[model samples]
Target: MSERLPPNTKIRGTGFNISDFWSWGFSDVLTNSLRGVFAEFLVGSTLDVLQQPRIEWDAYDLMYKDKKIEVKSAAYIQSWHEGQYSKISFGIEAKRAYNYATRSYTPEPVRNADLYVFCLLYEKDANLIDVLNTEQWHFYIVKTNVLNTLFPQQKRISLSTLEKITQPVSFTEIKETIDQAIYQ
Candidate 1:
């Protein structure tokens, strides 16, 4: 004879709740999705630009006027604990040709977008992951052409190195900063 347990019932003496473990695993995916969305929203709202909500995996996150903008975000406090400030790096991949038949990507040295926006959540205290706190978040904008020429073979750029080439700007100053980078 066998006994069936209820959906919410915990097994004999394991001492741990299975549902709690599942929630822990799912939190990573949720956190990442939220982070990306928050970054896009912050940029769009500050610049007074509308976001393209339906676009996915299309290279860029938002479209403003005649420019294509790619947004990348990083946080100091992630799933694990860190002893020091987290190093932030945003991917700058060249647009590649995809072969549908073979499902392979060919590397091309072409820039996909006009500009890149790097967002950082630098909270030394791991407890502060709240997107509502504007002071914890920082934004840096750089031109795609400048990044390609400076980084060349590198696909990622660190915040420190990026600061050498360009300074971090507030959300409200994004448009003016980008315009300066372009016209200068």
Candidate 2:
């Protein structure tokens, strides 16, 4: 298990601290990679799983209660500015699971998570975008069974295609919606 470090924890033989590294690396939360991790963190927070350390190579992003969750994120505004906002899509590909202990992979591809949470940063204006603001985002929750039945072979899905299936919920409703998806 990874130990949580204090912000003031110093690097040996260096003046920098953990906070310094975090500030330099994760200050831009809108970037694709960081944003995805941030979305996972947001969902984990909503599910009351923030106490758990994130496992980078885990087949699913989080395990809340008995439900395994996979989170995907997309945004209109990116860290780098272009003439137009980028198109939004989320990956839903099934892949073989990697075992850390055995140093082996599953024989076949599969959807390891029980459900998926799709997070969209809908704020179009770069200047008005605040990733920290929950109101600026929309989340769509769907059971793996339903998703697999709808688009069995689909590797990725567009926002429009996704909208036809599941309605989005606010940040505040995420946990409720997830419970509904899982329990109902």
Candidate 3:
């Protein structure tokens, strides 16, 4: 894994810095890719796993204690002009696991994580939307076994189906909920 450089690290023979690139590239937190990574960061922070830099293109998004976590995020209001709130669904497809040591993909498709954390930026009003606010987010933590049993071959899961599988938890309850899911 490549070490995460400090934001203040300066570019070679230039006035630019890593923070400059971050601001230029990732200022739009509402976009799918950035939002997904943000959700993972939130989960990692809640679980006290932000001590290390995130592993990109890994089989799972996080590892807290013994549980491997996958994070998926979607927002009601999009960065684009969708006129209305966007439809909410999360990808739950099985994927070929990547082995970092071997630097290769697994032969068979699999759900490599122990759990999934579905994060919803639930603020519908674009004018009042705040991606940084914890209250605006709702998280649903579900075991991989449950998903495999219910949606073995499904690629995406609608919000209604996700709700039926598990109720949403707030930011404060995430760690406790995950503990219960892991230990119970």
Report, for every candidate in turn, its global Cα lDDT versus the true structure.
0.71, 0.91, 0.92
Minimum summed lDDT over a 10-residue window in model 3 is located at 76-85
lDDT of 3 by residue, 27-125 (tens): 999888888999999999999988778877889999988789999999888888367878999999999998878979999998889999999999988
What TM-score does model 3 achieve against the real structure? 0.95
Sequence-dependent TM-score of model 2: 0.96
Q: How many Å off is the CA of 78 in candidate 2?
A: 1.0
Candidates sorted by lDDT, descending order?
3, 2, 1
* Most accurate candidate by TM-score: 2
Where is model 1 poorest over a 10-residue stretch in terms of lDDT? 1-10
lDDT of 2 by residue, 1-184 (tens): 7967889999888999989999998999989999999999999998998775788889999998788999999998898968588898899998999988898999999888999999999999877999999999999998899778988888998999899989999999999999888878
Query: Which regions in candidate 1 have their CA more than 4 angstroms from the true location?
Result: 1-30, 79-85, 97-109
Ranked by TM-score, the better of candidates 1 and 3 is 3
